[model samples]
Target: MRLPEVEDTVNGPFTMIWSLLLSLFASLTARSVVNGQTPAGLAPKAFLSLPLGTVKPAGWLYDQLVVQTNGLAGHEHDFYHYVSESDWIGGTSYYSSLEEAGSYWFNGMVPNGILLDDPTIQSQVQQFLDYVLDHQDSTGWLGPEVNTTKPRYLWGRYPFFFGAIQMVEANATLTDRVVTAFHKFVALANTMLHNGEGLEDWTRTRWEDFVIVLQWLYDFHPEGNEDLLIDTMKQLKYTGDPWEDVFNETYFPKTAVEDLRNPFPVLTWHGVNMAEGLKALPSTYRFTHNQSDIDAASKGWDLLFQYHGRPSGIYAADEYLAGLEAARGGSYLYQVIGDPKFADRVERITYNALPATLTGDMWSRQYLQQQNQIAAKNMTPNPFPEDGPYSNVFGLEPNYPCCTVNHPQGWPKFISNSFVTTPDQASLVQVYLGPYTVSTMLAATGNKVSVSVDTLYPFSDTLTTTIKATKAFTYYVRIPSWVTNGTISVNGGPSRPVSPTNGLHAVSVHAGTTEFTLDLPSEITIEERPHGSVAVHRGPLHYAFDISRSSRVLAQNAQQPLAVDLEFDATEAWQYAIDPSTLTFHTGTPAGGQLPSPIFDSGLPPFTISVAACPIDWAEGGNTFAAAPPTDPACTGAVTNITLSPFGSTKLRIGEFPTFKAT
Candidate 1:
């Protein structure tokens, strides 16, 4: 029979009652384990640090949140307090509450380098986990009690979503011997199983949110129990939110509907879910081998690219469902979605929003988040002549408290999670700015391989990836949509056919393990975005020029352009080359052999980076494309030379380039 709906809501007294019925649902079985069949090219454990790089920040942040969940971390003064509950970071309270407690412990702790079976914090945590499991029915459903007492259906609480994340981490490795047991636990509550009804009352919604945990669950059960999953999705979509409106269909594929309400037409469903959905969809076709899913994901990328797209390469998702924009609505939705494209997106977004948010060590909140209906973005919190709009800077109290703590996780995690591996296939190495390695056992060939990529991207184009194979099998690399002409050489061998996808290139390696080189031709390409902006890029390194030979601060404060306008001034056109041939980095100062002329009397010196810069720099709050008051030391690197600053260090500079016209 269908369980009561309130089961998914707040964990009340019902939790204790249901906890007894679902124990078996959590015990999933384990797959075959190869005793010593370590694949051929698997790297020494020393190289293990490579894969750990991408996950460290995420793990660290989860750890910190855990500390805060338990009142262990946070600088007392920084601790967040709320009225709705005793304390909260916005509406979420990881303290005291069991569900958020479940979320905080598992989501933040499990992927955090701790083994599920580890004994350290297991006693107490296990009590809760085991308590929930013991009650799970054979149908795979396990929870406290249902709040069916109310009319509204339970969409889901934090723990359910966070639980999915923990599940993925467990199944990622073969050693997760306990995954099978967990599946059995899930089976009891699942509708497909005997006596199981489904997600209970919170039916017909929460497909993606549930997948947050399911992705992890699927990871543990490589050969998933499809019946339970499909059954869960079936009842949840009883009357799926109508995509009839262009809002849900043409826009982001449903970035969460609030209790069946589609209030705002503007889009803020970017980032987190965009990343998650992208991760959920397979490269070729994992689910049903269906092409429609692939096409929909692609379109979703486009829509996300349009509305939620931020000055940073990533898309924006306001607090929850706010439209994509700076100020009040910016949020961190794309963080866990696990899609490669989202990775690329956030990489770009960082260039813009991150710096803006961190004016100086946690001093920026450019994207505003508000719970109310009105638009109270960066503006002061004003209601009618009541609360003014526009927030100037960040202090102990910004318009919202949640985004403040959550923002720091973006950069460190992005750099860390840039790559991954599947049981059978692996992602192709796209851009390599330095040396890094990846390890995975491909299911197709039952071979284990370790790939080490060595190069400097966005700074230098040429990179080499060495493949160490335990057995002969294929691997792949991404050919970015940005590259028009580039050469790929295997072990210095002739460049061969690399299946080219229009958006991003994915090159597969049929021969076991070998080193490959990619030589790309440098040229100027106008970034294609709505904001009419033009940037010059040679290989991956974006080129920027300082119109000021005297200071990094522009002599002309002339308003910087909002977006790139390809129709830039011809006479004053910004161009560069391996000029003088010896110049390592391309940089240019004021045109007249020297800057700080009588022109300085003209006010802020006008300057702009070439089109070679990365695409994310054009939006506001991004790399100062135009010019800025020099507060950063790297801004001093803007001498009248052909050298460039590390994209990560150029603080206090203009980024957005406006269309220039000659008199």
Candidate 2:
């Protein structure tokens, strides 16, 4: 089915070019290299991502990262065979035929460790890096797949190198070793791609990742080998899936993939692939300088959400890109295009969808999460076309080990990318609102800026930012599109209504201590969904019916009892249709000035909304998944006051509900 062409509203060709020129001007004048090197020859990015560890989690956000540190993310390698004894680290064991599980762990662990500044995790990462770097083959290849005869897939190395690059950026001491190793691997990759040796189906479809790392190397540590790097990018693009063409032509799928005919385009429809491939066209534009590539990138983004988007800000992809899954990719798009809409999308995913996948304590997670998940148990005859019965269950490995390792990247990357510098290095851009601190030097002004944000954002309406800089610089704070009447005040001065330019409100600061408070008023919003159902939102958080739940421990690791796989079942009635007319929002402070160790835990969001609702006969499909809310659900019980919590805080939830008239 041909999808109607979406108008280029947010990132039209003219807007894209204008943003690029502004970024380019900043790049040429800025002296700050704190966020690593700016684009060398490629298109100038609107914002330059700071090196990992430059931005540190603080306040409640810090507690969340600590929860992750004490949970599965920090300890998966201790007993999980995939990471403890994998081929990537010289063990005989393998996650599968392909040696990617270990790489996945490394990729996530690198940022998790760096952001927390956890010495134990940093040491573990260092040990693995030392081993991988020391074990480079004589053929200039990395990893354990060096057989010239059999088919070798290069997909795993993309994540590994991506993590390695972050490590180098965070700790410049590892620069020489990492740069040398990558040069060797790039040489071998050039040879392999030329002779058609290592490019397999997975590699061909997901070549943008390889190109991204190549661009990183060329910009930062090319070692006078720029031609080799650019040539490799061309080779990869030539052999890879034509994502630009895919989005530009009528080849893109317009309907749910499962609804389409047989012989599905598995490569394009795969959920994870689609999430990763969203950046392909924009990535290609960096090299090709083609305006259509940029246009297609924006058009593909619009089409994706139009056809497959969920209220939680993610699309459905239970393995295929059809229904809701906890996967997102717009931070990169925001950086590349400098569009607030991209940043807004990332904020939505982070606040609503990402946390929905993981247990509140950050221990276990689901392979697939739904917008209206009623239960977290093994489901037979489920909606997922390619996932197992246990896909929605919260456990150590739910349906697959892929999410177990890959989910760690979600929060850590969000924290790392929350604060970035404009290309000119003269201005600091706060792309996401959160409790964090940024310490970096601005290249243009040669000033050291340290900003500490203190607040329980999304839960609370205000954020207090404290800035101490050696020299004056401009600070750009992102004003989310959700805010209609926001205000900012400096040093307890009279509040002034914010007038944002391109979704960012800029404030100039002096050389010494400066503090400002931004208050973005929150209002309860009712969003009408398909069927007569409605979803509620306040700020970035999606509110849900927090049905009381009970947990049953299904399995536990023998060695580490803390590592347990559990399933949650709703204990109380969950079929409630809300009365939006009676909704009331409430707020409070943490008990003792310290947030809960796991801030996402139930009943700890510091805010709640009470609304009148009635029991409705919402049907369950496949004996597992909650069927869509009925078009005209009838009240089955008397209307009673019900409390709704942030969607991220609940295990068993009704995020989308059918509304009914009350007599």
Candidate 3:
């Protein structure tokens, strides 16, 4: 079938046609191979993700998720106009034709509600799910866009079903209904792609989202329609942007988008697109089983970080692929490839970059957070290529509504992916450390096992994991690559140094409740930055010089005053260069002898690092962003001791600092 001709400025007029033909030929071949015989080169995931609500947050992590529940994440639909009147929820108000704002909220809130078991959030989510499921078009299309003549974009459905899939996983009652609705939608989607109806710029660029959903259906509930699903996945891949080619050194932009030559590409340079595109090759590898796809995925990740990475683990992209902005995608990579570095990278992002973008209470967030950020107010002529002046401010929708609704998934999804089972379900792997508990039946032993991890990790170097099971099973714990001198002890036994294989330490556990203590000894490590500057790291947490700041409400919602936009200005001087030699770490007990409820609050961390710093003449970029630290910066004032806190704990902070000799 000849598909509609869509303009393809990036790859030229013939690219789409060629891709469609190639995909058609490939799908036919795959169907024949998959019909009676197993397709060759199908890659297997090292770890399989447990269903939603499998892992529940505990300790300080529980407090964090609770804060999110009470904050904007839970209440966005109550007041925020975008979500409150979203098209997906039977309202006309929406940010774009894609209707992403509501879907983003749904995607994040599903895991958030299910993980917390928060009835309030769960009810809110259920309403949307009911509307979408009940209101599905006779043609199998979802959402309010049911007009046949007008063009249909499948992009929004990707995120919408992302949440719906989770809801099905968490609530058994919704399984048949959700799955049935998806089957219809998939059937229609397969036809739409064949006719080239929804293959526009944004949808084309982010086709991986759709492919992921199709792959999920194929794996768990094909329902005798495996060929249709595989055909749709192939069509989505070929019709979508060629991400693997884009990430190559020849095509990938080495410098910032503004610095690149004229005729700047839209999707290629977009920050969010780059982030979503990072998983494209990996997603393709599952079906293609091509080794080059895997190689490209890893290489693309490295290239992105090497050129545009910030101290906080996220690379830059205010709107375009600018020098430094906050984003995340490592969890999917870790699950697919089982690369220890992917696990390490996701941990770093969760501990450092993710929280730094959010307010202490998770109510407000910045659209653009920088590693060297010292102010959270609007800035004119900022570094971002396409963002407005208010991009850096802490607000409901600072520069765009995307981040506001999208940021909620960061914490909840991280917690969901924290604990996963090996492919055979013989062993439960603690992929990352956090305050969480997992209860699952081991398929290998046919016994239920529950593991509870209690610790203030990334803040404290020690954690206690207790395993309870009816039968013996193997347990794998990830010892982060940063830990060089770590030890583990089982049930008061003599401590032994942790020996890791590919960043994981395995332990054999006997039935009926066993406990293990892991102590990861950490020290201040200085990583030199571009200039004669440094960023501090100890274990997973990144340390930053917390700048004193005062905030004022910029805008407030009349319906709910708590939903307000805030502008934070640094109250005290922020130009300080630290002496790495004098950095000292300190820890103490909280007043209640427990970690603070809102541990991410500024000045609330139980642990602190004191470093001697001298006032330096650090210039500001357009009266907002701090410029790169000068080479061998001279001290403007006497060196004084300053307290450094976890990067996530400070909204206004100097995470990257110039260094000087302490004389």
Predicted structure with the largest lDDT when compared to the true one: 3
With a 3 Å backbone cut-off (N, CA, C), the pairs that clash in candidate 2 are 26-424, 31-443, 31-444, 32-443, 316-323, 316-324, 317-323
What C-alpha root-mean-square deviation, in Å, does candidate 1 show against the real structure? Answer: 15.7
Compose the digit string of candidate 2's lDDT tens values, residues 1-663.
Answer: 011121122110000111344334323422222236433467667678899989999888887788888888888878776787343454465342135776788888899998887898889888888877776789876665433245556777888898899999898999999999999989999989899778766786788888889989877898999988977887777666656545543666665566664232257567777766778776766766656666777888877777678777777776766633322118888787777888888898898888878887777888878777777887766666677778877888887887777788888999999988888888788989989999998988899999999988877888999999998767888889889688888877778787777887778777999898998987789988767778888888888887788888988888788777777877888778887888898887877766665767678788888988998887777666677787677788798998898888887788887786665
Off by over 4 Å in 2: 1-40, 85-89, 94-98, 146-150, 261-265, 324-329
* lDDT, candidate 3, 214-281, per-residue tens: 87888888898888887788788767777776777887777677667522135766878887888888
Candidate 2 vs. true structure, TM-score:
0.90
Q: Taking the tens digit of each residue's C-alpha lDDT, what string does model 1 give over 511-539? A: 46577786544554444222333333344
TM-scores, one per candidate: 0.53, 0.90, 0.92
**Ranking of all candidate structures by their lDDT, best first:** 3, 2, 1
C-alpha lDDT (0 to 100) for residue 243 of candidate 1: 17
Q: Model 3 residue 618 lDDT?
A: 83
Worst 10 residues of 1 by lDDT: 7-16
Q: Model 3 — TM-score against the truth?
A: 0.92
